[model samples]
Every structure is written in structure tokens, then in C-alpha cells.
Target: MSSIPIRIPTASIYEELASARTTPKTVTSIHEEDGSILDYTERSSDGPSMPPHGLSNQALPMDKLSRAQLIAEQYIKDNKLLKAHEELIRCVALSKIIHGDGHWRLAKAFADLAYSYLTVRGLPVQAKQHAESAKNILLRGVDMSKSVEEKREVLGTLVTIYYTLGMSHLLQNNGRESYVSLQKVQKLIADLEELQEKTSVLGKISDKDIALALGRSCVLQEKLSLAMNFFEQAVKMVISSEGDSSAVLIGIYREMARAEQMKGRHEQAIHYLLQAHSICQAVYKKLSEKAAHTGLLLAKAYAAAGRSEYNENTNKYFTESLSVYQIVLGADDPQTQNTRVEFSKWLIQIGKTQEAYKMLQEAVGSETEYSETVAEMLSIMGSIHLADGKIQKGYQLLKKCLEIQTAVYGSQHSKSKETQNLLTALQKSGASWE
Candidate 1:
């Protein structure tokens, strides 16, 4: 029996896919207001169209598809995410033209495009839409898959679709939906593992990635113990794949620290934070923002531990954090100012009000704008002065704080009302402000 020859679709199909109003819309539509696709394709009106390798209309759709996929991968490797996103959009259109809308191949194309939207463009809503579309197509394709290889391929695509959907839900803060979708991903990965199939669908995602995401969703749902379990699982996976000194462990350690802190295991939290801080100091520049942030977390953990022995450690980390922030982010940067404010608050808590007041004074003096940070510093400075029996200075600072609160929060806001009440009480205390 002679098998029928498969005829490839002509360039006319590519033209229709390119020009038809009914074709899958590019993901750039999600950010059309920002003009992200300045020169995306032949349909782009803003600038000269960038056909794949300057291919003409006569180019075969399959050829264009292969080129688009290759270019997209290259763009991703080069960290040109926007360009990659554009090529992925082209691949989606070309895939539909080559393999009809319901084919598993098309579903795989949509899944790839969805993942690109999520990771490359940071557009979760678009990612969710494309992933759902892929899921619908895959559901039909899975039943039609005949060979074991075809079934495995469909399952791989399903895994990617579900994973993208899960992450998109997580990014949108829908914890329950995120957990459900991620659970499906976990089951699918297990199935693939049982089949002795390498998970090619998990290009950048791994068992550790799924575990970490599950832990985060569990954290959002307030399931502390379960979250810690998943976090520890992630830590173990990372340690097994990459040694303990791997920089990836820093984020996992921080997440574990947060979970411990939430569970009121302060010592455990401090232990995790110390590990993360040490990793940051070794992997990143000591004065880098990453190291400074880790130091800040460690300092906060020490302060929250509420032990006298940890006070020196707390102060040391706080000072280091603030100095690093000042040196790296500049003194006028909001992060630097925030670190200074946090350090001052910690100082006041430890009965170092004079030092706290001086730090706040320097911060306030450098301010060019009346921001919420300035208002907070002023309020704290006023309270410090009042506690020290410097009524005149306290009154002046309180008045300035009140003015800023009124301007920032409006006269009827709770903060403004509170400041107004404080000023009124000061006046009743016989403080003349003529």
C-alpha cells in the first residue's frame, strides 16, 4: 500500500497569516500604549518592518518559522528580551499557518510564546491568556496522539503550559489558583520522571523552581510549616545540583528565613539570614546593593530576636547596611534614606536617642523635597527632642512635620489629624509659638 504524500502549505498561507485580522494577535498588544513593538513585523506601522533575516513574501512559512525560532533563541541568549518576544510572536503566527490551530505543535508554539511573555516581558496577564489557549488545544491534541513519542511530546507541552499558567497566576497573587496549576505541573513532572523521559519542557524551570514557587504560594496562604518543607526541599535540590556556596542558595535561604520568622522561630530565622548574608558577601561585592539588602535583613532579624547579646550584631549589620547603601546607591537615593531611617529607629529602641537624633538630623538636612520619608524623620526627631525636654526644638520640628503631613496626606487624613492633635496638645501645654 502506497502512503499519500504530505504537501507543504504555500507562501500564500504565510501571507494570510501575516495579513489576516483573525490571526493570533501579537503579545505586544498588551503594551501597545508603550509602543514596545516599534519595528516588530510587516504589520508594524511605526517603523520599517523587520522580516526574519529580511526574508521576502515568497519565503516558505516553515522556513520562516525555523528562522524565527532560531532568532528568538539567539535573542534570549544575548539578553535582548524584547527582540526575542517579537520573534516568538512571529513563531506563533507561523506555527498556526504550518500546523492548523488545534495541533499539539501549535499548542507548543503558544506555550513557548506564553513563557516568553511571562519571563521576558513580565506580562503575566498575556502569559495566562496564551497558556490557557495552549491548554485548550493540548487537551484535544492529547487524545489524538497515537504514538508513545507523540504522547510524550503532548505531555511535555502540557507541562510547560501548566507551569506558565501557574506562574502567571502566582504573579497576579491568586494563590489558590496558582497552587492548583502548580500542583498539576508537579504531577506532570512526576509522570514524565516515571516514564524515564527527560523534561525538555522545563527549559529553565527545574524541580527546585517548582518547589520554590510552591513554597511561596504556601507562604501567601499562611501555611508556614508546609512552606518551610517545600523551601527545605528546594534547598536540598539546589545543594545537590550546585554546591552549598551556590548564589541561588542565597534567595532560598532568605525565603526560609522569612518562613521561620513568620513562625516566630527567631533564632532559626537569624541562622538562615546569616547564611544568606554570608553568601551575599562572598558572591556579590561586599558594598553591592544585594549584599546591603541581605545585611539589612540580617540586622532586622537580630533586632527582632530581642536578645542583648544580639544587639551588637544588630547594630553592626545596620551600620554596615546603611554605609553600603550610602556608598553604592548615593545618600539621596530613597533606599539609602530608608536604611538610615530604619537604623535610627533601631538606635532609639536601644536607648541611643542622641545618636538616632543626630542621624535623622543629617538625613533631614539633606532633603530637597517634602516626602513621606522626610515626614517620618521629622516626626521621630520631634519626639526625640520632646523626650529630651527640648520643648522649643520639639515644637518647631512637630510644626514642620504637621505641615508636611497636611501637604502629603491632606488636612482630613488620619496622619494629618494625628499631627494636628499633637500640635494642639503642645499648645495646651503652654508652649508659645508666636
Candidate 2:
């Protein structure tokens, strides 16, 4: 492949910027218009909390939003996305307001903020909107009034914004647009590479950017083999860019494992996931959310390995997934319980009905779990128990299940009627919900 030429930022430039950025950012305490600290939103384990990084809060007439953004940046450093979103939005809004609406600088802020949301919020739609805003602003032509450094900043923002747009398109199932944006990314990477080749000092930054673009592109293309290679490259670049000290290496390693899994290369996936798991465990103690998530991914890789390796180990991985999920989300969180319950079914299939029964009990009693989702949990439990000769116990659980169904959707709810019929049949067989 013909490597692109790109110039890396001068060491002096980074040193100066680092010094400037080191100054503790001033945060406006309040938004005059709403008394809501110029931040975007407040805490809600349920809804949007704060805007993440890359937002401009300068538009709010006050620095409150900037303050919020600062707060969000710290939270992001701590890996608290919800809190970061709250502050990042404030930061972007304030940046935009201060810089004037839709100004390139402000657009850059929006683009960065959107990037955080796409990765952390699990909300791609909103992320796409913000990235587009950035691209649109840069499209208006660079403001010549700005210095070279300023113009370069805008160009950099455009690169990231386009990357975000490409990923968002993939998530939205818009393959065509995704491909277009990816091509643009590739062109940008090539251009950056060329510049850095000529100016070797810029190599690190340019390589980091190129690796990110290539890794994402490969993953979206379903080229898992290539994706793994690019992701490894990205990890190396990330390490170099951040220096040997990194608090986030485990995450990238996990992502690398995911790419390998997509290729159905279980052995490699397990290797990377195990490395991720080890890093997460040592770096993070106390069953940290980060560790739990890494464990979850590792478990999935192990489970997918099926009997190709150790059957006992595979079961252990599923159990570990359930355990980690329970610690983070509690027993009732639908996603957590669902995982445990599903694993339980698989256990039953392997003649572990006794273990499955315990998981079922947890699923039934969990308030945090969605009770009305009988289509999977309840029905499956009912069938499993009945087949295993626990008819009476199954009938009772199934009755409670029906009552829950009827309570939310009325007795006429199709699922409810179906369960009711099952109960009726059970009665004829001399069985009881009690």
C-alpha cells in the first residue's frame, strides 16, 4: 500500500497547548436563562444526564456550560459517560454560544461532544446529528482570519466528525452512506499519513488517526481478520500517543477481542479477551464496572468456543457472566437476569436442570427484570419445568406469569390468553398454580 504523507504537530506546539490546557478551566456556576448550571442535563440512571466531551458551551452567554463541560471531561476520564454527557453538552453549548452559533470552532465542539455520545451513550442517532453539524460548518470554507493552528484545528475536527458520521450510518443500517463516509475517512488518513511521513515528528498523531479510521472501516466491512490487524495497530498507536501510562488499555484490548470473535476465530478472540480480563482485573479492583464489562466480553468469547476447548471452563464463563452482570445491574435488571436465565436454559440442555431452576427463581422474583416478557423467559421456563416433571411448580410460576401479563395488557392480551389456556389444560391434568 502507498503510504500517505502527513505532518505531525510540532513538539513545541503540543507543549504550548498542553500548558494552555493545563490551566484549570473556569466553569460558570449557573445559566441565567434556566438556573440550570450551563450543563445540559442532570443525573438520571434512566435518561440523558450530561453531554460528553467535544461540546462547546461558549454559546450560553455564560461560562456555565463550559463549567459543565469541564466537569464532563473529568467524569469521562473517570469513565462516567452519563455525567460526561451532561457536562460535555454544556461545554459544547457554551463553546458555541461564546464562539457564535455554528461557528467552525463551536462546530468542532459539537462534533467532539457527539463522538462521546456515540461511543458511550449507545445513542448513535444523536451523535450523527452533531457530527453533521461539524462537517457542515467546516464546509462553509475556513475563516482566513484564523491562524494556521486554528485552521488546522478545524481540519482535524472535520476528520473526526466524518468518522463519526460513517459509524452512525452503519448503526442506522445505511450501508451506502457508511461506505461514502468511510472513503472520505480513508482519503483523510492517506493525506494525514503523507504529511506525517514528510514531518516525522507528526508521525504519532497521524498514525493514531489513521489506525482509528482503518480499524473502524475494517470492522464495518465485516472483514474481521483485517479488523483485528487494524485494531492492533490502533492499540499500538493509542499506547504511543498516550505514552506507556494508560488507564484505558483494557477497553481497546476488549474491542480487539470483539473483532476477532466476529471472524469466528475463537482462539484468538479468547486470547485477547483473556488479556483484557487480566488487565482490567489488575488495574481495576473492587469489581469495578470496567472489570465487570470486560468479564462479560471474556465470558462471551469462552461461551462461543463451545466444546472446542474445556466444557467446564465454558460453563464457568457463563456463570461468571451472570455473576458480573448481577453485581453491576443487580438481579432484577432485565439484561442481567436475561443473561442468567438464558445461561440457565443452556445448562438444562446439558442436564443441569437443578441449576436452571435456581436461575428461573431469580428471574421470576426480580422486579428490576421486565416481568411481562413471557415470550422468552416465562414460556421457556414453563416448558423446561414441565418437561423436567416439575409440572406443579411450573404451573404456579406460569400462573403468576399470566397474572402479570393480564395486569399490564388485559385478560384479552394474546399472550395472556395463551397462558390462561395453558393453566386450564394443566388444571384438567389435575395440576395447580398453588
Candidate 3:
């Protein structure tokens, strides 16, 4: 729990430095950066006070708290979780010491500490504990404050803490708890809105975010219609701002597509995906990972809906998606290889057997891992070989695919059984394209 202490540079230090400009006759010394403070003597020309008891003293060093926060932020940016945890813990301890346990600043420090544990360290239990502590402190501070602005600040931190708790619960698959926490966030946002103040602490957070969170929670609970309503609200909130906030609009569109797909409305899903793709094109104005991914989603919706144009969009998206995946995730990455296999399946569906065969061959040649990607590629290659009039080669590849499927899915699985039946039929018919 102990951390190395860093020296604080108080706001008074800046004032002192500024005062040095007018008092050039007096000695002005700069402190060395070796963690020491420079002492300054006062030169008040207004003469010595009669009592001197009411004179203000030099300001305390408070910048160390800000410095500690900055250090923790950089540690998080660098993915140094342990260091971030240590620095935030130090900040929290120092804040409690300086501001006492009930101050809103201490509550904020506790919230930051909880975030470090939750996001950086992935320690949900500790994160929840810290969040609870922060919430308690903020509640106490809110009760003690008379001003609405002061109470709002505490309430904002409280909302964020609940949001963190909700996300943590969601990640742990505690759907009911996540929903409850997020519901609290919604309630707090509504309360803040009723204040009719322009400086509402919830300014950065819109109803759209609350709706999206609720929608995702509803999705987890299998309430498709309810989820769709929330997605609709989120979409409505940002639709007018699409030109300025295409990124947000794109995400909402994708979520809407997901809800539509779950409801077996593939055409509607495709509509949302196309809207997302249009935003990606207009906002980015160039080839980007977002555009490529949106293209893939559109292709998927097309395929799912049994559209005749599936192959056209599939081929276009697969080409761009594969290229971007290679550039962003590396050529040999399992994800890139898996994407190639997925693309091959579409190619084979459209009678482009040679192209599919070439793509699978590259995947099989480089990928040594025994994954579903490899097995799928083998199965696709088998079909390609059969199309090319190579029965023996196709049968051999089919057997390999069956073996992998049996190993991965077990012999009793539908996938293994299907592959087994295919091989059996191939043998019985002695099929040959020639």
C-alpha cells in the first residue's frame, strides 16, 4: 500500500515566481528539480502589521495531487496496470489526508482508484469495493452541501461509479445487476435534466447513451423488441447530428442491425448496415477499418437474407476487409487467416472454385494451428476439388476435414455428422465432375 512520494508544486509557487519579476532587487532563486522546495521571503512594502496575527501564510503545496493523477493517466495509456494502480492508490490516500474522508475531491480520487482497478487491473471485486467507498463519500458530501452545483458534482461522480459497477457486472454476466445499476444511472440523468440548468453535469452524457446501455442489457435478456425501442431512441437522438457525429451514428446503426438480425428481419438488418456504411464513407472519405467492417456486416446481412446480390457485396467487402485486416492485425494473424477462410466460403458459394481453392491453399500452407478455420478451409477445398473433377483428391481432403471436425466438434455433433454424411455419400456415388 506504500508508494514513493513525489513533491508537490503548489499554485502559490507560480504566484511567487510572478512576484519575482517586480522585485528584481531581491534575490530570486529557482529550486532544483531534485524534489525540494525553494523558500521565498516576503517583501511587503505596506509595512509590518500591528498584530501580524491575521496575516495570511504561504499556500500549501497541492499540485502533487494533480501530478499523481497525471502519472496514473500516463501509466494507463502505456498499459502499465501495476504502476497505474499504485499511483492512483497513492493519490487516494493523499487526498483523504488533505481533504478528509468526506470531501467530494476524496470521492473523486476513490472513483479514479476504482477505475484503475476495474479497467486497468481487471479486478472487479476490488473495483466494486472502491466504488462503494467512493459512492458513500459522495453521498455524504452531497448531503452536507447546500449549493446545487456542489451537489451536482457529487451526483455526477456517483453516476459514473454506478456506470462502472454496471459495466463490471455486465462483463461478469450478471445481467440483472447490470440492468439495475444502469437504471440508477438513467434515473440520475433524468433528475439532473429536471433541474433545467445548462451546466448539467450530465451534459457530456446524453439520453442516447442511457438508451444504448439499456438496449444492450435488454439484448442480453433476450427482449428483442424492447432492445429495438432503445436502439431507436438512440438512433433518433443522433440522426440529426450524423454529419458531425458519424462515428456515434455508425455504432447505433450497427446495434440496430443486430436487433433486426435477432428478429429474423435480415432485410431490415441490411438497411441499418447500409446506413452505417454510408456514414463511414461520408465521414471517413477513404478506405478505413470501419468502412471495411461495415462492408462485411452488410455482406453478412445480404447472405443471411438469401439475396441474389450476396456474392457481389461479399466479394467486394471480403477483398477490402482482408487487406485492412492484414495491415492492421498483421498478415499471419489468426484473425486475418480466419477472415480469409470466411471469404473463401463465399467465393465457393458463387462458383468461383478456383479462387476459393487458391485462398484456402494459402491459409492451409501458413496456418499450423488446429482451429475451426483450418477445418473449414479443408472442407471448402474439398468441395472445390470435387468441382474441379478431382474425385480422389477431393475425397482425401473431405476425409481430413471430417477428421478435424470429429476432433473439434466430437463425432456426435451435427457438424461432424454432416461432414461424415457428405463423405459417405461421396463414396457411395463415386462422384466425379469429369
Task: Estimate every model's Cα lDDT from 0 to 1.
Answer: 0.81, 0.63, 0.70
lDDT of 1: 0.81
- For each candidate, give its TM-score against the true structure: 0.84, 0.62, 0.65
lDDT of 3 by residue, 1-434 (tens): 32333233234444454454355333323343454433333334464322111222332224545666787777878978666766676577557656766888888887777766666667677677778888888666356357877667766777778877876777676767878988998887776667654246654456777788778888788788988898888888777655545578888889889988999998889898888888887787536666767877776677677667565776676787788767767766666787787777777666677887898887688545566877888888887778777888888888888888888889999988988998888779956534
Model number with the top lDDT: 1
Relative to the unseen true structure, what is the C-alpha lDDT of residue 81 in candidate 2, on a scale of 0 to 100? 67
* Better structure of 1 and 3 per TM-score: 1
| The best candidate in terms of TM-score | 1
Off by over 4 Å in 3: 1-87, 98-105, 116-129, 136-142, 194-200, 203-206, 240-245, 309-311, 323-333, 347-355, 366-372, 379-434
Comparing 2 with 3 on TM-score, the higher-scoring candidate is 3
For residues 305-407, could you state the per-residue lDDT of candidate 1 as single tens digits?
8889999999999999999999999987888888888899989998999999999889888544677888888999999988877888888898899889888
In candidate 3, position 140 carries an lDDT of: 60
* Model 2 ranges with Cα > 4 A deviation: 1-123, 140-147, 170-179, 189-221, 239-247, 286-289, 320-336, 362-377, 389-393, 405-434
